[model samples]
Target: MEYGCYVCNKIIKTGEKFTFTKEGPVHMDCFVAAERKKVPEGKAEYLRNLSMILDYELTMLVSLLSLKSEDKETSELIRRRINAIEKQAGETTGLIYNL
Candidate 1:
């Protein structure tokens, strides 16, 4: 029988299967590591605050760039540059996978 790893999403061929907090299946090795890294729900507020802080920093950077002078030619260049960076970032930071 085969089982699926819930964390890394790899297929478990012969090792023991473990269940995640979200009720997903994983290989024992993967699950153990994930469990070690788990954080308590009470501390989630700290992570949320950190995310908000990072988002504010990103917004400030964009605002500062928007304050710079721009003509049509420069605008097009900026647009293309932003698009390329966004595309690469999206590819590297994709959030979903199915098993």
Candidate 2:
């Protein structure tokens, strides 16, 4: 059976190194490149932006885990921000595929 890559939205043939996530199967290299592209232009800017984003995600995850049951609104807001950041990261990393 043919499987589709989550990042490139293309068919993944046999003998490809891939991992399965909740979303779907994704090629290993595609996933790594996508993660690397989640930053600004220039090496320095990219590193800085990536570090900040990772830190923010970590902090939000911690806060989300510690939130009280009644604070549904606050939890939802944080979740939305996290989702936005993830989407931006994915978009920034221009998708590349191997033939």
Candidate 3:
């Protein structure tokens, strides 16, 4: 199935990069940037929390793009940013590992 970005109205194919949002489908870059804009300056904790939310959202994205796995790459960029946020806040990934 071909998904069209609600913002750009561009035809987006599975794994071609799209973000699932309450507002509907949007480009991945658009989604990430919008998410980043929501974070306030000097708020590492907020950033960390945002990262967690993004990570969970990305996990859902992965599932949605399951059929496009052959041409898809995991949202590693978001993961890296999340890791950095965790590191900056002196938090560890294992914090939630036990849950």
- Could you estimate the TM-score for every candidate? 0.31, 0.37, 0.39
Looking at candidate 1, the ten consecutive residues that score lowest on lDDT are 90-99
Q: Report the C-alpha lDDT of model 1 over 20-43, residue by residue, as the tens digit.
A: 334565544464344435546664
Candidate 3 residue lDDT tens string, 10-65: 88765554445556766655554555565456654655665566465555545543
**Model 3: residues with Cα > 4 Å off, grouped in runs:** 43-99
Better of 2 and 3 by lDDT: 2
Q: How accurate is candidate 2 locally (lDDT)?
A: 0.55
Task: List per-prediction Cα lDDT, in the order shown.
Answer: 0.46, 0.55, 0.51
**Ranking by lDDT, best first?**
2, 3, 1
**Alpha-carbon error at 7 in model 3, in Å?**
3.2
Every model: Cα RMSD to truth: 14.6, 9.6, 11.2
* Top candidate when judged by TM-score against the true structure: 3
Model 2, span 24-87: residue lDDT tens: 7776556656655753354645554544554454455445545554588877876776577555
